[model samples]
Target chain A: MKGAEIFVQSLLREGVDTIFGHPGGAILPINDALYDSPIRHILTRHEQGAVHMAEGYARATGRPGVVLVTSGPGGTNVVTGLTNAFMDSTPIVVFTGQVPTPVIGNDAFQEADIVGITRSCTKHNYLVKDVRDLARIIKEAFYIARTGRPGPVLVDIPKDVSMSECEFVYPESVHLRGYKPTIVGHAGQIRRAAEMIAQAQRPVIYAGGGVIHAGASEELRTLAELTVIPVTCTLMGLGGFPGVHELWLGMLGMHGTVAANMAMNDADLVIAIGARFDDRVTGNLEEFCVGAKFIHIDIDPSSIGKNVRVDLPIVGDAKHCLQRLLQELRSIDKDWKAAHADWLAQIAAWQAKYPLRYHQEPEGELLPQFVCEQIYEVTQGEAIITTEVGQHQMWAAQYYHFMRPRQFITSGGLGTMGFGFPAAIGAQVAYPDALVIDIAGDGSFQMTMQELATAVQYDLPVIVAILNNHSLGMVRQWQQFFYGGRYADSSLEVSPDYVKLAEAFGAVGLRATRPEEVRPVLEKAIRLRRPTVIDFVVKTDENVFPMIPAGGSIKDMLLA
Target chain B: MPTANDEIQRHIFGLLVENKVGVLGRITGLFSARGFNIDCLSVAETEDPTVSRITLVTAGDSRILEQVQKQLNKLIDVIKVMDLSEEPHIARELVLIKVNAGAETREEVFRIASIFRGKIVDVTPKTYTLEVTGDEDKIRAVINLLKPLGIREMVRTGTIAIARGQRVL
Candidate 1:
C-alpha cells in the first residue's frame, strides 16, 4: 500500500471523521488516497480558511481538527492560522505536501522550507521520508496534537514518500525515544496543595483552557462549591465557569473587571488549575500576589513557573489533580471563613460602579454593548461567539456572558486581526444546532471578509455584527489616548461598503446606525436564518471604557 | 548519580541539518514523539546550498539524547545533529520589541536599545520598535532594561545556535 494510504488508515484508527483542506500538487497523492477513504474532506477556498475551520472544528467538538495543503505558499499560508490555533491551545493536525524527496535540495518548483518556517508555531511536526514510517508518524502527530495541553501539529509529507509503497501496520501505541508527557500527579505535591487550600480562608480558583481540554469542568465546579471559593477564568477559560454564577467573577485579563482583579489581589490563597498566568492577567508581576500562597496545578511541568511563580506546584492533568485534592480535603474546617465580607462587598460595589456602561437610547441607536447583551439574552448564553481581535473582541469579552465551555472562541494568544468570521464558520460546522456569531470590528471584518462567500455557499446561518467605526478603532484609540491624537495609517479610508461586500459574497446584509435600528435589524437578521452581516456604524472616538493604559497599573484604569 | 526524577538538567542544542525540504519536519517529529520541547529554535542556511543547520535547544535526559540521535539518523536528508549543550556554542535569537514611549520614556528606550546594540526598526511618535539579536540571557536582559519604559508589543524568534567547532552539521 502507498504511504498516504497508510496515513489515512491511521487517521481512521483514531476515529477522525473529517478533514478540511485546500489541495495542491505536492499533496495530490494524499488527495488520491483520500478518494476511497471513509474520511470526508471539506475543500476550503483558502488554505488559511481551512486551518481556521479546522481550529473551529477542534475548539467546538473537542476533537483534533485536520487540514491538508500543498507545500510552499500553501504551507506558508497556513502558518499564521497554525500559530493562531497554537496560541489558543486548539488541537489541529495540519498535513502539507512537499516536493519529491530526491528533488528536495534542487530548489524545485513550488518548494519552500515549510517545516523550518513552521517550527516555532507547531507543538511538533514530521516529514515522512520513508513509507515505513508514514503510519507511525501520522499516529504520533494525532496523539501529540490531542493529548494534555493540546495544540497544532504539522506533518510535512514529501510527494515521493506519499506515493511510495510499503507494508502498513498502524501502531497501537506510540513509543518515541524523546517524548513522554506526565499524566499522573505526584501524591506528595497533591497532599501539600490540598493542605494549603483547606487552610486558606480567602481562596480563589483560577481556571484556564486546560480545564476544558482535560474535561474537568465538573470536578472544578465541585471543588469550587465544596470549598466555597470564588472562581475567575482567563480569556480562554471563559466557558469553563458559568459566567452568571454567584461565585463567578468573569474572564480576567487586560480588560478584566475591577471586581475580578480586586478579588484576585485580596485572595490569601490562589489555586491555579490548568491556567498559565499570562501577562495580561498579572499586570505587575511583583504586585500580582503580594502575600498569597500559590498552588499551581498543571499537566505540563514547564508551564508551572514559566510565567508566574508558584509556592506549591502540583504537576498533573487538571482532572487527576483535582480528584486527588478532593480526596485529601475530606477533613474540612467549617469554622474557617476568610472573613472577606467587607472585601466581597467591595467587589460587588466595584461591579455595580463600572458595569460595562454605554449610552443607550430607548428610541435611538443600539449600543454595541446592548447588542451583545441582546444576543446573550436571545441565545440564553448558549451560542458560541467568536470575534476578530480588536475593540469588538474586548467588548464581547466584557459584555457577553458565556455560560458553557468552548463557547467564546477568539484569537487570544496570537491576537490575529481576522480570525473571527472564518472561525465562526468552522465553529458552526462543528455545532450545527448552536447559534454562532462573529462579533467583529469594521476594520478587522474586512481582513477576512471574503469568507462570507464560504458561509453563504455552505448555507451556514452565522450572524456577524460589524461594529463599524470606519477606522482601526483600537490603534486609533491608542493613538488618541497615548500619541497626542496623531492618527497615522489607522483609518480604513478606502474600502468597499460592507453591505455591498456582503451582497457580493451572496449573503444578506443589514445596516443599523442608530439604537432603534440595532435590535430590529439584528432580530430580522437572526430570523432570516442565513449568513448576514449587520453593519452598525458606532460612534467614532468612543473608546473601550475601563482601559488599562500600557504600563499603567490596574489602579490607573480610565473608567468613564 | 542521575536519578529517574532529577531536575532534568536542561540541554541547549544546535543542529545543522540538510537544507533539504523535509529535514525540520523529521527532526521535530522525533522530538515531539518523546514529548521533548524545543524551547528555542532558529534555522537558516549557511553558505552551503545542500545543507541548512537548525539550532535547537531542548531539555531532555540521556535517553532522549540517544533517541534524538537515532530518530534523526532515520531521516534520509538529516545530514548531522550537534547537541550544543555539550560543546562551546554560539547561540542567538532576534526580537522585534515595540515599546510605548512618549517624549520622556523615548530617551530611556533609546538609551537601553543603544546599550544593547539594537537597531530601531520602526518609530512612531509614541512607539519605538527595536530589533535586537543575542543569546537568551541577553534578550532577557534587554527586556528587563526596557521594562521600565513600557513594552507595548514584543516578538521573539526563540533561540538559534551554531556550535564552535572545526566540524559543522
Candidate 2:
C-alpha cells in the first residue's frame, strides 16, 4: 500500500468518519487517496473553518475531531483553531501537507515550517521523515490527542511521504519515555486531602474545565450534595454543575456572579477541583481569599502551586480523588458549621438587590439575557451551545442553564476572538442529530464569516445567533468603563451585510430587533433544517456588568 | 554573574547541520536571534558526507537537563549536540588562583595546598594555584571561601568535562 493509503486506513481503523479540510497543491496526494477511502472529507472554505469544525465535532461528540490542510497559508490558517483547541482542552488531530522532501528547505512553493509554527500551541507534533513512519506517527498523534488533558496534535506530512509506497502497519502499542500520564491518585495524598476537607469550617468547591473533560460531573454533583458546599465554575467549567441546582453558584471570574465571588472570598477553606487559578479568576492575587487554606486537586502536577500556592496539593484525577474523599468521609459532621451567616446573608442581599434585569420599559430591542434564557428554556440544555468571544459568550456562560458537561463549548482561556461560526459547524457535524447554536457577537461573527459556506456545503443545520450591536462591543464596553469612553477602533460600521453574506453562502438569514420577533425567528431557524443566522440587533451601548475593573478585586464589582 | 576574579568556562559542542537553505540561519538564529543565552558557538564541516557540525555550550543543572538535548533535536538542521561530560577518559583543566598575602601569611598559604597535593602553577610572590580538579562545583567552593582571605587573580579553563565510565560522543 502507498503511504497516503496507509494513513487513510489507520484513520478508518480509529473509526474517524468525518474530516474537515481545504485542498491545496502539497496535499493533492492525500486528497487523491481520500477519494477512494471510506472516510468522508468535508471541504471547508477556509482552513481556519476546518479546524473549528473539528473542534465543534470533538466537543459535541466525545471523539477526537480531525482536520487536513495543504502547505504554507493553508497550514498557517489552522493556527488560530489549534490555539483555541489548546486553550479549551479540545481533542483535535490536524494533518497538514508539506512540500516534497527534496525541496523542503529550498524555499519551495507553498512551503512553511508548520511543525515549528504550531509548536507552542499543539500538545505534540511530528514531521514525517519517511514513508515508514506514516502509519505509526498518525496512530501516535491520535493517541496523544485523545489521552490526558486532551488538546490538538499536528502531523505534518511531506508530499513525497504521502506519495511513497509503504506497508500499512499501525502500531497497537506506542511508548514515549517523556510522556507519562498518572491516572490513579496517591493513597496517602488522598487521605491527607480528605482529612483537610473534613476539618474545614466553611468550605467551597471551585471547579474548572478538567471536571468536564474528565467526565466527572456525576461525581461532582454527588460530592456537592453530600457535603452541601456551594460549587462555582470557571468559564471553561460551565455546565459541569447544573446551573439550576441549589448548590451551584454559577461561573466565578472577572465577570462572575455576586454570590459565586462572595462564596470564594468568604470561604475559609477553598477546595479547588481540577482548576488552575487563572489570572481572570484571581483578579488581585494578594487579597484573594484572605484566610482560605487551599487544597488544589488536579491531574497535571505542574498546575499545582504554579499559580496559587497550595497548603495541601493533591495531584490526581478529580473523579478518583473525590470518590476517595467520599469514602474517607463516611462519618458525618453536619452539625459543625463554620459561621458564614453574615457573609452568606450579604451575598443573598446582593443577589436579591442586583439580579440581572432586562428593560421592563421596552425600547423595542430584544435583551441578550432574555434571548439566552429563552434558548436555554427551549433547548432545555440538551443542544450544544458554542459561542464567539465577547459579550454574548459571557452572557451565555452566565444565563444558560447547562445541565450536562461539555454541552457549553466556548473559547475560554485564549479567548480567540472569532471562534464561533466555524466551531458551530464542527459541533453540528459532531452531533448531527442535536440542535447546535453558535451564539456570537456582531464583531466576532465577521472575523471568520467565511465559514458559512462550510455549513451550507456540509448541510449542517447550525443555528447562528449573531448578537449584532454593530460594533466590537466588548472593547467598546471596556473603553466606556476604563478608557474614558473614547471608542477607539471598536466600530463595525464597514461590516459586510450579514444577510447577503449568509445568502451568498447558501444559508437562511433572519433579523430580529424586538423582543417579540426574537423567539419566532429563532423557532423558525431551528425548524428550517438548514444553516441559519439570526441577527439580534440588541442595544448598541449595552455592557456586561459585574466587571472587575483593571487591577481590581472581584469584590470591586460594578453591578448593574 | 561572574566574579571579577572568577573565569568563564566555555564548552564546545559538535552539531551535524543538514544542507538546506536557511538551515544555518534556523540554527544560529535559535541562539543570538532568540532569548536563549549563547556564550560561544562555532560551526564547520564534519567528517560525515553532506553534514556540518556546530560547537556551542552553556551552563546549568543536571536536574531536568534532558530538555537541552530534546529541544535541540527538534530543530531541523541540528542532528545532535552531545555533552562531552558523557564521554569517558580523564581530562585536565588549567586554572590560575592568586591568593592575597603580605609575606607574613604568604608562606602559610603555600604550606596548606602542598600537603593536600596542589601545585603552585603561577606565582607573583603573593599568590599561587593550589591547582585542583574534580568538577565546577568543587572548584567554585574553594574559590568562594578563599576570596575573604584575599584573591587577586583567578583563571579557570572553563570546563572540558568528560564521563567517568567508558563512553564516546
Candidate 3:
C-alpha cells in the first residue's frame, strides 16, 4: 500500500466521515487519494476557514474535527485557528502537508516548519518521517486531540513520506508514557466539597465549557437543582446548562449581566465546576468573590489552583466529579431549597435590576440587541448559533437563552473576529436538518465572507445575521465610555452591499433597516432554506451594557 | 530585610516534555515572544524514550514568574513543570575549559585542576583542556580561578536539577 492510501485507511479506521480542508502543491498526493474516498471533504475557500469549520464541528458535536491543508502559507494560515482551539479546548486534528523530506530544511518552495510554528498551541504534534509510522501517528493524533481536557493536535506529513510505500496497520490504542490526565476526583476531596456545600447558606454554581466537553450537563443540572444554587456560565460555558432555568443568572464576565456579577460578588460558598477563573470572568482577581470558600472542580490539575486558591480542589472530569458529588449530597438527603431562600430571593431581586437592557430606537432605527431577540423568536430558541468576536457575540450570548449543551459556539479564548460563519458551516455539516446561524458583525463577517461560496456550493442553509453598524461596534462602544469618544480607526463605513454580495455568491440576500423590518426579513430568509445573509443596518453607537471597567471588581459593574 | 530586587530571583524549572521535534522551539519561543529572559537552559531525553527532561533557569519577579507558570502550563507539549527554586535540590553544570598554558605552567594548571577536582581532558603545546562539573556557584568559582592560568576558551552545558529526598519531579 502507498503512504497516501494508508493515511486514508487509517482515517476510515478512526471513523472520520467528514473533513474540512484546502489544497496546495505539496498535498497533491493526499488530495488525489481523497478523490475516490467515501469521506465528505468540505473545501473551504481559505485555510483559516477550513480549520475554524473543523473547530465548529468539534464544539457542536463533541467529536474531533479534522482538517487537511497544503504546506507553507496553508500551514501558517491555520495557526490562528489552532491557537483559538487551544484556548477554548476544542478537539481538532490538523494534517498539514510538508515539503518532501529531501528539502524539508532547504527552505524549498511551498515548505514551512509547521510543527515548529504550532508547537506552543498544539497539545502534541508529529512530523511523520517514515511511512511505516504514519498509521500509528494518525491514531495518536486523534487519541491526543479527544482525550483528557480536549484540544487541538497537528500531524505534519512530509510529501515524500506520503508518497513512500509500506504495509499499513492502524494501532488500536495509544499508551503515552508522559501523558496521563487525572480523570476521577479523590473521594476525600469530594466528601469535603459536599460537606461545605451542605453548610453554605449562599452558594453559586459557576460552570464553563469543560462541563459541556465532559458531557456532564445532566449531572451539573442535578447538582445545581438539588443544592438550590443559582448558576452562572462563562462565555464559553453558555450552553453547558439550561439558560432559561429559574436559577440561571446569565453569563458572568467583563460583559456579563448585572445580576450574575452581583451574585458572584455576594456568594459565600462558590461552587466552581469545570470553569477556570479566567481574568475576564474574575474581575479584580484579588477582590473577586471576597471571603468565599471555593470548591473548584476541574479535569486539569494545573487549573485547580492556578488563579484563585480553593478550599477544596477536586482534580477530575466534570461528569465523574459531579456524579460522585451527587451521591455525596444524596447521603444527607436534606432539602436545600429551604436552606437558602433569602439568598435566592436576593439574587432574583438583582436579576430584576437592569437585566441586559437596550433602549428602543426612535423612527424605527435598528438595534443589534433587537436583531438577536428577533433571531431568538424566529428560531424558537433552538438554532445552533455560532458567533464571531465583539459586540454581536455578546448580544447573541445575552439574548439567546440556550437550553442545552453544544447549542452555542463561539471563540471564547482567542476571540478570533471571523470565526462564526466558518464554524456555522461546520455545525451545519454536522446537523444537516438543524438551523445553524452565524451571528456576525460587519467588521468580522467581512474577514471571512469568502466562505459564502463554500456554503452555496454545498447547499447549506446557514444564515449570517450581519449586524452592519458601519464600524467595529465593540471598539466604538469602548471608545465612547473609556477613551472619551475619540473613535480612532474603529469606524468602518458601510461600503459593501452585503445583500448584493450574497446574491453574487448565488445565495439569498435580505436587508432590514427599520426595527419592524427585522423580524419579517429574518422570517423570509430563514424560510428560503438556502445560504442567506441579512444585512442589518444597526445603530453605530449601541453599547453592550453591564460593563466592568478593565481591572475593576465585580461589585463595581457599570449598568446603563 | 529582602528588598524588591531580591524578589526577581533566578528560578529553576524542571519540565517533563514529550520527546518530539520542535519541543525546545516552543519553550524558547514562548520566553522570547513574551519578553521573558532565559538565564540558562539544558534539555535531554529522559529514561523514558518517549519523554524529555528540560531544566530552564529564568529570572523574574513573583508576578512575572507566576505568569510564566500559567502560560507554560497551557502548552500541550509541556507535560509537567515543577519549580525547584523554593525547594532543596541538586543542580550541576559541566564545562570544558581550555587554558593557554605551556610546559612550565602546565604542571601548575594540573595542580590547580586537581585542587578543584577537575580532570585534564586534553593537552596541546599551547593549552591544557580541563573538564569540570558543579553547581552554579562552584562552576563560576572554578572558572574565576582558571582565568589566572590564562584561559583560552570555555563552554558550559547549562544546569540540570532534581528535588532532594523523597520529592520527585
Candidate 4:
C-alpha cells in the first residue's frame, strides 16, 4: 500500500472521525489521499486555528484530536496551541508535513526542523524516516496523547516517507520503554487520606480539570455530599462539580469568589483532586491554605508536592483514586455532616455576605458581568462555554454557574488569548445540538478573528459574545492597582468592528450597547442558529473584582 | 537552622535521561529558560545503552533545589531524578592547566602537582600542561596553588558523581 493510503487507513483504524488541518506545499499528497476518505476534514484559516480546534475537540471528547499541517511556518504556528495543551494536558496529535529526506537539511521550500521546534512543547514527537515505521509511529503518537496525563504529541513526516510505498501493518498496542503511568492509587495512602478526612471538622473538596478529564464527576459529587465537604474548584475544574449546589463555593483562585478562597484558607483539611497547585490558583504559596492539611490526588506523579507540600498524596487516575477514597471512607463509616454543621454555617455566611455579584446598571454602562449573568440565565447554565483569556474569561468564570463536567472549557494553564473561538467551534462540532458559546474580550477576539471564516465555512453554529471593551481590561485593571495606571502597551487602541467582520463571513452579527439589550441580543444570536458574533459594548473601565493581588495570599484579597 | 532564613547551599543532582537526540538541548534549555544556574555539569552513557547519566552542580537552598528537581522530572526525556546532595556520593573532576613556568617555577609547579596527585600530560618551552583529578574542593586548591605560576590556559571537565559503595540510585 502507498504511504498516504496507509496514513488514512491508520486514522480510520484509530476511529478518528474528524481531523482539523490546513493545506500547504509539503502535505498536499496526504490531503489528496484524504479526498475520498470518510473522515470529516475541517480546513482552518490558519495552522494555529487548526491546532486550537484539535485541542477543543480533544478536551470535549476524551479521544485525541488530529491535526495536519505543512512544515516550517505551519509547524511553528501550532507551537502555542501545543504549549497550551501541554500545560492543560489535552490530548492532541499534530502531524506536520516535512520536506523530503534529501532536502531536509537543505531548507527546501517549506522545510523546518519541526521535531526540534516542538520538542519542549510536546509530550513525545517523531520524525518518520521510513514508511514502514509510519503506522507504528501513528499508533504510538495516539497512545501517548490519550493516556496517562493526556497531552499533545507531534509526528513530523518527511514528504518522501509519506509518498514511499510500503506494506501497511498497524500495531495493536504500544509499549513505550520509559513510559508507564500509575493507574491505581496506593491502598495505604488512600486509607490514610480517608482517616484524615474522617477526623477533620472543616474539609473542602478542591476539584480541578482532571476530574472532568477522568469523567469522575459522579464520584466527586458523591464524595462531597457523603463527607459533607464544601466543594470549590479551580477555573479549569469549574464544571467538575455542580456550581449551584449548596456546598459549592464557586471558583477558587486569584479571581476566585470570596466564599471559595476564604473557605479554602479556613478549612482544616483540603482534599485536592485532579488539580495542580499552579501559582494562579494559589496566590502566595507560602501563605496559601497554611491552616489546612492537604490530601492531593492526581494522575501525574510529579504534581504531588511540586507547588505546595501535601500530607497524603495518591498518584492515580482521578476516577479510580476517588472510588478508592469513597471505599476507604465507607470502610471507616463516619457521619461527616453531623460533625461539620458549624463549618457549613460559617461557609454559608461567607457566601451570603459576598457572593459573586455585579450591578446591572440597566440605564448606564453595559457591564461585562451582567452580560455573562444574562447568558447564564438564558442558557440555563447548560451551554458549553469557552472563554478567551483576560477580564472576560474571569467574568465568565465568576458569573456562569456551570452544572456539568466538560462544559466549561478555557485556556486555564497557558492562558492563551485566542483559544476560545476555535475551541467553541470544536465543541459545537462535538455537540451539534448543544449551545456552544465563546465569551471573548474585544482584545482577545481580535487575536484570532480570522477563525470566523473557518466557522462559517464549516457551518459551525458557534456563538461568540465579544465583550467589546475599548482597552485590554485585565492588564488595565492590574495597572490601576499596581503599575500606577500607566497603561503602556496594554491599551488596545485600534480594534476591528467585530459585527461587520462576522457579517463579511456570511454570518449573523448583532449589537448590545445597553444592559437591557444584553439578553435580547444573546437571545437573538442563540436563536439565529448560525455562526453569530454579538458585539457587546461593555464599560471600558469595568474591572473584575475580588482579586488576590500577585504575590499576596488569598487571605489578603482586594474585594471591590 | 529553624530560625534563620534560607541561605545558599551547593546542591548536586544525578539525572538519568533517554540517550537520544535533543536530550541535551531539553536539559540545558530548561535551565536557561528558568534562569537557573549550572555550576558544573557532566553527561555520559551509562551501562544501559538506552539511558545516560547527567550530574549537575547548582547553588541554591532547599526550596529552589526542590523546584529545579521537580521541573527536571517533568521533562519527558528525563527518566529519573536523584538529588545526590542528600546521599553519600563520590564526586570527581578532571582539569588540565597549562602554566608558563619559564624554567623558574617549574620545580614548584611539579611539587604542587605531586601534592595534588596530578600528571604532566604535555610540555612546551615555557609551559607544562598539568592534569589533575579530584573532588571540587581539592580541584579548587590545586587551581589556587597554580595561580602564582602564571597559568596561561585552563580547562576542566565538569563534575561526574555516583553514590558511595553499597548505595544505588
How much does each candidate deviate from the true structure in C-alpha RMSD? 14.1, 8.1, 3.0, 2.5
lDDT of 4 by residue, A252-350 (tens): 889998988989999989999999988888887778888899999999877887777788989899999999889988887676777889999999999
Interface RMSD of 3: 5.7
RMSD from true fold, candidate 3:
3.0
Better of 2 and 3 by TM-score: 3
**Could you list the chain B TM-scores for each candidate?**
0.85, 0.54, 0.93, 0.93
* Candidate 4 residue runs with Cα over 4 Å from true position: A483-494, B1-7, B166-169
* DockQ, structure candidate 1: 0.03
lDDT of 1 by residue, A1-560 (tens): 88888878888998988888888899998998999988878777788888888888888889999999999889999999999987788999999999999998689998998877787688777777888888888888988888767889999999989888999898889865345556788999888887887777677889998998888888888887777678889888888888888778876667777777767888889889888887777876767767688999887765676556578988788898888888887665553335545545666787787676787777754567776777677677777899998888888988888777788888888888888888898888887766899999988887777778788877889889888878898899899988999999999888678788888888988898776676678778878889998888876667777776765556776776
Clashing pairs in model 4, backbone N/Cα/C closer than 3 A: none
Ordered list by TM-score, greatest first: 4, 3, 2, 1
DockQ of 3: 0.30
lDDT of 2 by residue, A402-453 (tens): 8888788888888877787888888777778889998899888878887887
Clash count for candidate 2 is: 8
Error of 1 at A422 (Å): 1.2
Candidate 4 root-mean-square deviation in Å: 2.5
- Compare candidates 2 and 3 on DockQ and give the better one: 3
Relative to the true structure, how large is the alpha-carbon lDDT of every model? 0.80, 0.78, 0.90, 0.89
Could you tell which candidate, 1 or 2, scores higher by TM-score? 2
DockQ leader: 3
- List of chain A TM-scores, every candidate: 0.96, 0.96, 0.99, 0.99
True contacts kept of each: 0.00, 0.00, 0.21, 0.18
Candidate 3: stretches off by over 4 Å: B1-20, B30-37, B45-53, B58-89, B99-111, B122-128, B146-150, B162-169
Better of 2 and 4 by TM-score: 4
